[model samples]
Target chain A: MTVPISYYVVLSGLIFLIGLVGVLTRRNIIIILLSIELMLNATNINFVAFSAYLGNLSGQVFVFFALTVAAAEVAVGLAIIIALYRHTPSINVDDFRLLKW
Target chain B: MDSLIFFYFAGIILVTATLVVALRNPIYSALSLLVMFFHVAGLYVTLHAEFLAAIQIIVYAGAILVLYLFVVMLLNVKREERIHRQSLVAVLLGATLLTEAALLVFQSKGPVFPDATSSGSAGEVTGNTESIGQVLYSTYLFPFEVASLILLVAMVGAVILSKKGLLDQKS
Candidate 1:
C-alpha cells in the first residue's frame, strides 16, 4: 500500500504546471498570488516525499523554512496589493501599467 | 489500503489546487486554497512527517488563509476580470514542462529509493518531532535564526506598505 516516490514527484510537477498556467493566464493579481502559493505547496509535497523515502530529516526541515518564508511573502505581497489598489482602485494585472513608459 | 488512502488525499489535493486557480471569485479561490492546504497536510501525515503536517495545518490553513481572506475583504473589489484566453506561448511552455517531468520520472536511472540508514537513525530517535528538533537546533540553528529574522523584517515591511501615509492629504 506504500506509494512510490515517483508518484509524488509527478503529482507535484502537475500541480506546479497548473499553478504556472494560472500565473501566466490569469489577470487578477490575487489569483496570481494564490497560484504562487499552490506552487510552493507542490514543492512542499516533493520535499516531504523525499524525506520519507530517504529516511532523512533534512527535507522536512527545509519545508519548515519554506513555510516560514511563504508566510512572510504573503504578508508583504498582500500589503503591496492593498497599497496598489488604493491608487488605481483595481486588482486587475492588466490595469497595472505604471511602468509602461 | 494505504495506497487507496494516498490516492484519496492526492486526488483531493490536485482537484482543489486546480479549483484554487480556476475559480474566478477571489473569495471562492481562497476557500478552495484552504481545502488544498488541509489535504496537503494529510499527505504529510502519510509521509510520516507528523510535525510538518501539524505546521501545515496551523500555519497555512489557519494563519496564512486568514490573511488572504482579510485581503479579499479589505480590497472589496467586486468585478472580477474576464478570463483571458490561454495564449499559445503559455500552452507551449506548459506542455514542455510536463514532458520534461514525465521523462524524469520514467527514464531516470539507478535506485529510486535511497538507503534506509540515512533515515534509520530518525526512527531510533523518540519521534519525528524530536528527531527534527535535534537537527534544527544543532546543525541548522543559524538558518533557523535567519528564518525568524526574515519573518520579523516581513512584518515590518507589511506594516510600512499598508499603513496610511502622511504624504496624502486625506486620511
Candidate 2:
C-alpha cells in the first residue's frame, strides 16, 4: 500500500498530543522543553505534508521562518533558564512563582 | 514500499518522543528527543518539501536539538530520583491525554489527502520553489525582512543576558 499524506498528519497529531501531554503533566523544565521541541516538529511535518498535498510552496517557506523563530526562541529561552537556575540552583519551573500579583 | 518507509520513520519519531517525555533521566530524554527530531526530518522528505526537509535537519536536528543536549550536559542533574516525582495531578492529566488520543484514533479516517494532484505524481505535486521565491521576494518580502531583524534582536538579547554578570565579576 502506498503511503498517503494522512499517515503523516495522523502521526503529527498523535505526536503533538503526546507533547502536549508532557507539557501539561511533567514538572521537569528540561522535559517540558523537549516536549515543546516535539510539538514544533509535529507542526513542521504537518506543514510539509500539507504543502506537498496541496501543491503549494508557501508551507515550505513558512517552515523556513518557523525554523528560524524556533532557533531564536530556544537560544533565548535556555539563557533565561540558566539565569533562573543560577538564582535558585534548580530548574523546577513551578518554583518560578515569585510574581504573586 | 513508500508506506513501509513512512511508517518506519513515523514509529521511530513517536516512540522516541515518548521516551523523551516519559524517562525520568533528563539527559536520556534529551538524547531521545534528538532522535525524534531526525525522524521528523525524514517525514518532511517524504512529503516532497525538499527545502523544508533539509532545514528540518540543519536547523532543528543540527542546531536547536544540540543546544538542548548541551544544556542537559551542563545541568548535571542530581542522580537522585527525588526530582519531579510524578504527582497525582500528573497522573490525572496523563489519563486525559490517553482519552484524547483514543478519540482521535476513532474519529480519524486514514490518509486525508488523496495522491491526486495537478502533476498526477505525488512527488512532483508540490515543486513550489519558484512561487515561494516570488512571494518571498515580493508580497511577503517586508515580513521576511522584518523577521530577520527580529531574529537579530533576539540573538543580541541572548548574548546580553548571558554576559550580564561576567563583566561585574571581572571588574
Candidate 3:
C-alpha cells in the first residue's frame, strides 16, 4: 500500500514548525527570509499531498499560484534587504530598531 | 517498499530543513536548503506530481536559491549572534503548536480521499503535465493572469527599491 496521508501531514507540520521557530528566533534577516521560504515549502508539501490523495488538480493549481507569489516575495524582500543594508551596512535584525519601541 | 522510500525522503527533508535554520553561515544555510529542495522534488515524484517535481528543482534550486546566494555574497553578511532574545518563548510556543498538530492528525480516522495510486479515474488517464496544463490554462485562467500581474509589479518594485539614489533624486 501507499503511504498514508497522515504521514505527509505530520511531516509537513514538523517542517512548518521548524520554519516558524526559525523565523521567530533567528537574528539574521537573510536567515529569516530563508525560514519564510521553509514555511512556504511546508505549505506547498501539504497542498501537493492533498492534491494527489484527492484526485484533484485544483490543489496543484493553487501550488502554482503559491510559487508565483513566493518568487515575487523573495524578489521584493531581497531588494528591501539590500536597501536596508546600504543605509546601515548591517543585516542583523537587532540593528533595525527604529520601528521597535 | 513505498513507505521505505517515503521515510528516506522525509528524514532527509526534516534534517536539511533544520540545518537550513541552524547553520551559522548564510551560504551553508542556503546550500542545505538546496539539498532540501532536491529531496522535496523526489517526494513530489513519489506522489505522482512529476511536473511539480521538475518545477521544484528548476525554480527553487536553480533560480531562487541562486538569487539568495548572490545577495549573500553581495552583502558579505557575517555570522550572526547566538539567537534572538525571545527564543525561549518562541521555542515553547512552537512545541505547543507541534503537539496540537500531532494530536489532530492522529485523531482523525484517515484522509477522506482515496490514495493516488489506488484511484484510477478522472485526471489519472492523462499524463500529469497535460492535465495540469489544461486546467491551469482554462479553469484557472483568471488567477493565472493575476499571478503574472503580481510578478510584473514585484519586478518593478524590486528595481525601484534597489536602485541607487532614486528616492534621493525625487526629494
Q: Please report the candidate that would top TM-score against the real structure.
A: 3
- Model 2, global lDDT: 0.75
Query: For candidate 1, lDDT tens digit of each residue in B103-137?
Result: 87678886557644444665443227988999899
DockQ (C-alpha based) per candidate is: 0.67, 0.54, 0.69
Model 3 Cα lDDT, one tens digit per residue, B1-171: 999999999999999999998988999999999999999999998888899999999999998999999999999978579665677887688679878876887788856766667665864632289899999999999999999999999999999999997545643
Q: List the residue pairs that clash in candidate 1.
A: A55-B119
- Identify the runs in model 3 with alpha carbons over 4 angstroms from their true place: B115-120, B166-171
lDDT of 2 by residue, B1-171 (tens): 888889899889889988987888888887888788777777766766666666677877788878887887887765433335566777788789789868987897655555644434434646455666775787678879978987898899788767657434533
lDDT of 2 by residue, A1-101 (tens): 25666676778888898898788777778788888878887887888777777666677777777777888889888887776676667776767777667
Query: What is the DockQ score, from 0 to 1, of model 3?
Result: 0.69
Candidate 3 lDDT by residue in tens digits, A29-98: 9999999999999999999888888778888889889999999999999999998887778999889886
Error of 2 at B44 (Å): 1.5
Candidate with top lDDT is 3
Those runs of model 2 whose alpha carbons end farther than 4 Å from true positions after fitting are: B79-115, B118-132, B166-171
CAPRI classification of candidate 2: medium
Q: Which residue runs does candidate 1 get wrong by more than 4 Å?
A: B83-86, B96-104, B109-111, B115-119, B123-127, B166-171
Model 2 Cα shift for residue A23 (angstroms): 1.2
